[model samples]
Target: MSGAEVAGLIAAIAFLIIACAIALIAIRIGGVTREIKDTVAEVNKSLDAINAEVGPLTHEVEALLTKSNTLLNDVNGKVAAIDPVFTAIGELGESVSDLNTSTRNLASKVTNGAKESGKVAVAAKVSKKALSLLKKKPADQEAVTNGK
Candidate 1:
C-alpha cells in the first residue's frame, strides 16, 4: 500500500479501538445504574412494610403513655388527699409528748411535797415528847415536898 493510505488505515483502526472502549464503559455504567435502581426499589418496599407495622405501634405507645400519666395523676391525688392525715398524726404525737412532759412535772412536784410533809411530821413528834417529859418532872417535885 502507499504510505498515505497505510497511515490513514492505521488512524481508522485506532479510532475504532477508542470507540469500542467507550462502548464497554457505557455498558458497565448501564449495569451499575440498573443495580442502583433495584436497590432503591427494595428500600422503598422495606420502608412501606415498616410504615405498615409502625403506624399501629405508634398509636399503642401513645395510649400507653396517656394511661401511665393518668395512673400517676391518680396516685398523686391520693397522696395529696392523705397529706392532712399525716399532718394530724404528727400533731397528735406532739400533743402526747406535751402531755407526758406535764405528767413528769406533776410527779416531781408531788415527790417534793411528800418529802416536806415527812420533815414536818418528824418535828411534831419531837415537840410532843419534850412537853410530856416536863409535865412528869413537875409532879415528881410536888410529891417529894409532901413526903418531907
Candidate 2:
C-alpha cells in the first residue's frame, strides 16, 4: 500500500473513534435529562397531594377562628348585661357598712347612759344622809337649852 493511502486510512479511523465518543456522551446526557424530568414529575405529584390535604385544614381553621370570635363577643355581651347587678351589689355593701357604723354609735351611747345612771344613784344616797343629819341637829340644840 502507498504511504499517502495509509495516512488517509488512519485519519478515517481516528474520525470514527471521535464520532463514537461524541455519540456516547450524547446518550449519557439524554439519560440524565430523562431522570431529571422524572424527579420533577414526582415533586409535582407530592405538592399536589400536600395541597389536597391542607385545603380542608385551612378552611377548618378559618371556621374555628370565626366561632371563637363569636364566643368572645357573646361573653363580652354577658359581662355587660351583668354590670348593673355588680353596681347594685356594691351599693348594698356600702349600705351594710353604714348600718354597722350606726350600730356602733348606738352601743356607745348606751354605754355612756349606763355610766351616768350609776353616778345618779350615788348622788341620791348622799342627799338622804345629809337630810337625816340636818333633822338631828335642830333636836339636839333644843335639848341643850331646856337643860339650862
Candidate 3:
C-alpha cells in the first residue's frame, strides 16, 4: 500500500477505538443514573409508608401525654390537699416534745420536794429525842435531892 493510504488507515482505526470507548463510558453513566433514580423512588415510597404509619401514633402519643399531664396534676392536687396533715403531724410531734419537757420538770420538782420533806422529818425526830433526854435527867436529880 502507499504511505499516504497506510497513514489514513491507521488514523481511521484510532478514531474508531476512541469512539467505542466514549460509547462504553456513556452506557456506564446511563446505567448509574438509572440506578440512582430507582433508589430515589424507593426512598420516596418508604417515606410515604412511614408517614402513614406515624399518623395514628402521633395522635396516640398526644393523648398519652394529655392523660399523663392530668394524672400529674391530680397527684399534685392530692399532695397539696394532704399537706396540712403532714404539717399537723409535725406540730403534734412538737407538742409531744413539750409535754415530755413539762413532765420532766414536774418530776424534778416532786423529787426536790420529797428530798426537803425527808430532811424536815429527820430534824423533827432529833428534836423529840433531845426533849426526852432533858425530861429524864431532871426527874433523876429531883429524886437524889429528896434522899439527901
Candidate 4:
C-alpha cells in the first residue's frame, strides 16, 4: 500500500474510536439522569403520603384536646352546682354541734337540781317526826300532873 493511504486509514480508525467513546459517555449520562428523576419522584410521593396521614392525625389530636376541655368544664360546672349543698351541710353540722352542747348542759343542770331537791325532802320528813314526838311528851306530862 502507498504511505498516504496508510496514514488516512489510521486517522479514520482514531476518529471512529473517539466517536464511540463520546457515545458511551452520553448514554451513561442519560441513564444517570433517569435514575435521579425516579429518585426525586419517589421522594415526592413519600412526602405526599406523610402529609395525607398527618392531616387526619392532627385533626384527631385537636379533637382530643377539645374533648378534654369539655370534660374539665363539665366537672367544674358540677362542682359549682353542688357548692351550695356543701355549704348547707357545713352549716347543719355546726348547728348540730351547738345543739349537742346545749343539751348536755341542760341535762347536767337537771341532774343537779334533782339531787338538791332530794336533800330538801329528807330534811322536811325529819322535822315532821320530831314535831310529833314533842306533842306526845306534853300529853304524858299532863296525865302525870292529874294523878291518872
Candidate 5:
C-alpha cells in the first residue's frame, strides 16, 4: 500500500476512537440526569404525603389552643369572684382585734370601780359606829331603874 493511504487509514482510526469516547461520556451524563430526575420525583411525592397528613393535625392543634384559652379564662374569672371573700375575712380579723381591745379596757375600769366601792363601804361603817358612841343618853338609865 502507498504511504499516503496508510497515513489516511491511521487518521480515520484515531477519529473513530475520539468519537466513541465522546459518545460514552454523553451516555454517562444522560444516565446521571435520569437518576436526578427520579430523586426529585420521590422528594415531591414525600412532600405531598406530609402536606396531606398535616391538615388535620393543624386543626387539632388550633382547637386545643382554643380550649386551653377558655379554661384559663374561666379559672381567672372564678378567682376574681372569690377575691371579695378574702377581703371580708381580713376585715373580720381586724374587727375581732378591736373588740378584744375594748373588752380589756372595760374589764379594767370595772375592776377599779369595785375596789373603790369596797373602800367607801368600810369608811361609812366606821363613821356610823363613832356617831352612836357620841350620842349615849342618861335619861334612858333613870327611867329603866324606876320601872324596875
Candidate 6:
C-alpha cells in the first residue's frame, strides 16, 4: 500500500481503542452510582422504621407519667380520708384507758369489803362459843352446891 494510506489505517485503530476505553470507564461509573443510590435508599428505609417504632414508645412513656400522677393523687386522697379515723381511734383508746382505771378501783373496793365482812363473821362466831361454855359451867356448879 501507499505510505499515507498505511498511516491513516494505524491512526484509525488507535482512535477506536481510546473510544472503547472511555466507554468502559463510563459503564463502571454508572454502576457505582447505582450502588450508592441503593445504599441511600436502604438507610432511609431503616430511619423510617425507627421513627415508626418511636411513636408507640413515646406514647407508652406518656402513659407511665400519667399513671404515676394518678397513683400519687390516690395516695394523697387515701391519707386525707383516714385522718378522721385515726383521730377517732385515739379517742377510743383514751376512753378504754379510763374504763380500765375505773374497773381497777372497783375491784379494790370489793376486795376490801369482802375482807371486812370476813373479820366480822369470825368475831361473832367466837362470842357465840364463849357464851355456850359459860352457860354449861353454871349448870354444873348448881348441881354440886345442892348435893353438898
Every model's TM-score: 0.63, 0.54, 0.70, 0.49, 0.50, 0.44
Which of the predicted structures, 3 or 6, would earn the higher lDDT when compared with the native? 3
Model 5 TM-score (2 dp): 0.50
Please give the lDDT score at residue 2 for candidate 5: 100
How many angstroms is residue 81 displaced in model 6 relative to the true structure, after the best TM-score fit? 1.3
Per-candidate alpha-carbon RMSD to the true structure = 14.5, 15.5, 14.2, 15.7, 15.4, 15.5
Model 4 misplaced stretches (Cα beyond 4 Å) = 1-48, 119-148
Whole-model lDDT, model 4 = 0.92
Error of 2 at 125 (Å): 20
Query: Weakest 10 consecutive residues, lDDT, candidate 5?
Result: 136-145
The order by descending TM-score is 3, 1, 2, 5, 4, 6
Give one digit per residue, the lDDT tens place, for model 3 in 91-128: 99999999999999998997788687886577679999
Model 6 residue 15 distance off true place after TM-score fit, in angstroms: 30
Candidate 6 runs further than 4 Å off: 1-47, 119-148
Residue-level error in angstroms, candidate 2, position 113: 1.9
Please provide, for model 4 over 31-91, each residue's C-alpha lDDT reduced to its tens digit, 9 standing for 90 to 100. Answer: 9999999999999999999999999999999999999999999999999999999999999
Q: What is the C-alpha lDDT of each candidate?
A: 0.92, 0.91, 0.92, 0.92, 0.91, 0.92
- lDDT tens digits, residues 27-107, model 6? 999999999999999999999999999999999999999999999999999999999999999999999999999999998
Colliding residue pairs in candidate 2: none
Better of 2 and 4 by lDDT: 4
* Model 4: worst 10 consecutive residues (lDDT sum): 132-141
- lDDT, residue 76, candidate 2: 100
lDDT of 2 by residue, 28-139 (tens): 9999999999999999999999999999999999999999999999999999999999999999999999999999999899778868788657767999977765677666
- Candidate 5, lDDT over the whole model: 0.91
